[model samples]
Structure formats: C-alpha cells, structure tokens
Target: MPELGGPTSAPALLRPHDPAPPLLDAARLGVAAHRGLDVEALLTWTTDTADLLPLPGTGSTAALWSALASVAAADVGAARVLEPHLDALAVLAQAPTPVDLGAVGAGGSSTWGVFAAEGPGVRLEAHEVDGGWRLTGTKPWCSLAGTLSHALVTAWVSDDERRLFAVGLRADDVLPAAGPWVSRGLAQVVSAPVTFDDAPAVPVGPPGWYLRRPGFAWGGIGVAACWWGGAVGLARALWDALGAREADQLALAHLGAVDVALTAARACLVEAADQVDAGIDGKPSAVLARRVRTVVAGAVEEVQRRCAHALGPGPLTADEAFARRVADLGVYVRQHHAERDEAALGRDLLAAGVAPW
Candidate 1:
C-alpha cells in the first residue's frame, strides 16, 4: 500500500480486490480450525481466493507482495501453504512452453505446491518416454503433499542438470509418505517426502531454466515479504499490549526499534518490487533476492526479540494467537538460509566487483 515507486508515480494497475480481506477473514475463521490442524479449511480458503492474487513482476508487483505479506500477517502457516501455490502459478506462467493454467488447479477446484528441494541419497529423475517425461524416485520437502492436487516439481534430467515439471498428486503412482514432521509451528501443514513411481509429468521449463529464471529470485524475495508481514503482526501485538497499560521506556524503546527495523525492511521490499517492474538492475536477481531476504530476515529476528522482551511472558503464555504466531514465524523464516545466503551474496558481489556504499 505504501509508495511502491517515486512520489509522482501511481500504481501501474489497480489491484482488483484488496488481498488482505480474504486472508484476514480466513485468519479469524482459522483460529479455531488451527487447534484441530484443519488442513481442508486452509485449502478451501486458498482455492477460493487464489484468483484475487496477481502474478509477480506484472507491473502490479507491489500488490502481489502486499498480498503475500498480508497472508503472513494473518497466519504464517496459511502463508506457508499459499505462497508456494502462487509461486507455482507464476513459474508456469514464465515457462517457455505454453501451459494450460487450468490443468494445474487454477480453476479453484484444486490446490498446488512447489517441490524442488533435493536431498542426499535421494533423487527424482525425469526420463523421456514416448516423447513425454515421467518422474521417478523420491522428492524431499514436498509440503502439503497429501492434500494438494498438483505440484510443479523439479527432477534431474542428467547427473548435474535438473528441470521443472508439473505433476498431478492425485495420480495412482504418487505416494506421499506419512510422519517425520513434528514442529509446533506450522503444525497443521506437514512437509514430508513424496515418492513418484514412473509418474507422468509435463516439463514446465527446460533443464537449468527453473533456477536461472529471474522469477526464481523474485519468488525468494516474495517469501521475504512474508517474513516482513510476520514481523508486522508481532509488532502490532506489541503496540496493542503497550497501549493497554502505561508502558515503561524499555518497552517503548523496543517498539521504536521494531518500527525502525520494519520500516527499513519494507523500504527494501518496495524498491525491489519497483526494480522488478522497471526492468531490474543489470545485477543478477539472485543478488537482489539475497539482499532483500537478509534484510527482512534480520527484521523478523529483531521484531520477535523485541516483542518478547517488551511483553515478557504474558502474551507468550496467555495469548494463543500470539504464541502460535511467534512459533510459526520462527519456523517459517528459516527458509532464508541465514549465514549461507549472506556469504553467497558476498561472494557474488566480490566476483562482480560492485562497490558497497
């Protein structure tokens, strides 16, 4: 909602409907459902509201990020589930081969997730059969594997090359394994391994294209937007609590610190979205994504720490939503890859010979 560009700039296109309403309303409705770890309710909400979200880098990039952030603010777990689905759609949209979006759950009848993570001793290999691809072996970190009807997954074409493919989860050969997920945060959304036994797939993009695409970096930054939103939610809780009582200087100072961290992170996100639309700087998108993710991740950590220090044990112990939020965000932001990402960014900059201001 804040200025995505300069003072004189207007939104390239007006978002058809505000992304916050459906997510916030779902958050309120899902509070009770969360206790039961109701996965269906979340899926229903995702399918019903999927159309409201816009594709990233499509001039209205800020709106898309705003929607992702709103979802995180409302419910981190919901954001966890929904973000990948949206990312998958965007991935398909960006693919060189034209895809029938409706075939991949864009019709509001099904849900989707992205399963691209590869693990040690496990590989999902894609073999060309009858001029088509069939994914075999296991894929790790397939979130919502049991519930989602489709996924945009990555499988190795050769020893070192991997390509993205769209596969239907409802197919007879797709097997979603049970157990191994026991985190308190995102308790409802289980991310376990899934094995594909000669499962038919449609290649979304050519080998090496998935990670090389600019949208890959944009998707990573979009996750950071969720981190920013999660921080916002925590900061809001701290503010509300402080307002109810005469707060001491320490508590108020923590709030101030929170505001500072969030503002800077938000500014970075806005600028990144603007760059994406305005034809991003000559620098690689990986560089931009790393910078934004690092900033937002720091903000998330700061806000969580400040909120805890300012409010003490009261909210963590008595406020269910607050406690769940804290836990969910703690788990969710780990996607940033912390020190390794920072180091990669440093290495990239050094190689590029970019001067740091």
Candidate 2:
C-alpha cells in the first residue's frame, strides 16, 4: 500500500496470514461453512493485516473506504466483508474514540462475514414488534449469505410507505431459497433470495435511515470502489494482453484511454473521501458520491469493451480468469447510482454555484 500523508502516518496493518493478492482473488471462495466462527477470525485477520488504520484524531472514513475497495477487488466472493463492521465503522467515523490501529484493516475477512446472500426473491417488509422488529417477506440478491454473520438488509417498514430499515440477519432470521445464482459472472458469490417468515431483527438506525445521511452516499461510494477495482483488474488483464502481442494498436489506444479514465475516477474517489472526512455536508457529498460512481462505471465499461476487443473470442472462454472478471465487473458496475439521478444532482450543484476546490 502507498503511504498517504496525514496526521496519522502509521503504516496500515494487515494480517500475518493475509496474502496480498487482487481483490477478486480474495473474494473468490464463498463464505466458510461456519460463518459465525469464521467471521471473527476474518476480522482479526484483517486487523492483523494492517490495511485498515485509523486517520489520527478524526475518522477512519478514508481508510475504511479504501479498505473496502481493496477487499472488493481482492475477493468479490468476500467483497461484502465490511457489512458486519458497519457498526464499528459508524462508531469510528462519528465519535472521537481512539481507534485500535492494530485492529482489523479493510481487506481482513472479518468485515466480509456480515452479509448473507440468500433470500426468497421478494422485497421484505418490517413491522415494529413489541420488543424490536419482525421482518416478514422475501429478499432476493443477498450476496455472501451462506457465510455472513448477519446481513445489513434494506426493508420497507410497512406497506404504502417509503420507509427503510437496516436489519441484521441471524441464524433463524433468514433461510435460503432453492436454486443457485445463475448469473454470468460472480457465480461463486452465493447471491440468492431469502425468506423471513416473521423473522426477528434489530434495526441499525431509525426509519428512513437508509436513504438519509452520509451513510447512503458513502455506501454507494464504497460499492463504486468495487467496480473501480474491477476496472483495475480488467485494465491489468488488457495490459497483459498487449504485452503478449494479442492486442492491436486500436486496442492499445483504448486501453490507454481506460487508464486515463481509471486515474480520473480514482482522483474523484479520493477527493470525495476527503470532502466526506472534512464534514462537508449535504449535496456536496451526494454530488461527489455520484461523480465517483459515474466515472468508475464508465471506466469499467470502457475496459470491458477494450479487453473484449483486444483479447478476441479466446478470452471469453469460461475457463479464463479475464472472462470471469468481465462478468464480475458487469455485476459490480450496475450498483452505481443512476445516471439521471446523478446528472440532476450535478445540475443542482452547478445551479448553487458550487465550485470545484
């Protein structure tokens, strides 16, 4: 990892057993058989790895976000590792508590165990119960379900309203549906639907919390890092192809342009993180989040196109790692904020005389 200058100049910690590999490689395998047992281990491993260090007196916002991106690229299988660590992250970002710098870093496996990837393929509804909340419904596309300790799921509070709640999953909270995930890419991701027949859950925050605050924007930005990492993987693959003389001049030019796009996208991401750390409120964060997503999405698309063109039909063969990356990139890029919504935000920023710093 590159040394980033700040008040907190300590080296980022990684686990002793942490093998520094690409994000996809780390996330390749699905969750361990005993997710509960392994979640803490992964977290410990991440902290030991020294990747997630606190930024001195302020928040670990930038470090955590960067760690998420690194983990996403390292292992799409384990990409959701940070979900369980959200509570700790929120605490670290919001409070002035002295962060255990020796604790889990972003790429450590502990953070990945929070999300479970099974569901009933329907949106769930949450009801305020006597003690807490009862979640009854179905949720599709719960990635990493089999191994996650809990899932930070978004569910409607009740019918006919837009209220959303972030619920944590437990053993009895969710059950997997039949059939496996048949997606073209990220097949090992364990993304499936889950059913909650009056499952009990604890709400992370108040109603409408998912949509409000910097968490939502930050979540989007965090996911965007995964896409950006995928782009990096694709670009590297393209570079390898060029080295092998498999790419033509046009393909090479396109790859160069992709490099430019990735650089620009990364700059925007860091800038957004800085702004977020500085406590620049409201629309600025939203706009920066949108920009990071848009730039990354575009970069991934360009790399996919260039890689496909350069590598020819052989690269698409299922056995090839590059082919798998393309599929993963496609799935990851779809998580970006909508283009129209981002554009409208940009327009609002411009109308408000927001100047780039």
TM values, all candidates: 0.89, 0.70
Candidate 1 per-residue lDDT, tens place, 214-310, comes to: 7998999889998887777787788778888999889879988988888888889888888888756335677898999999999999999998888
TM-score of structure candidate 2:
0.70
CA-lDDT, candidates in order: 0.79, 0.55
- Taking every candidate in turn, the Cα RMSD to the unseen true structure, in Å, is 4.9, 8.0
Off by over 4 Å in 1: 1-37, 100-108, 281-283
Q: State which candidate has the highest TM-score.
A: 1
Encode model 2's per-residue lDDT on 1-357: one tens digit a residue.
Answer: 222222122212222333333221233222211131244555444444334344311444555555555544444433444433553345334323342322112222333322322344467787877866677878776665665544456677656443333344444656866447777765655566777877766555455544565555666676776676556656666666677676667876877777677777777766666666677556766776777778778877876787677667887875355666667667766755467867776796787795765
Model 2 segments more than 4 A misplaced:
1-60, 80-123, 158-170, 246-248, 337-357
True lDDT of residue 232, candidate 1: 75
lDDT of 2: 0.55
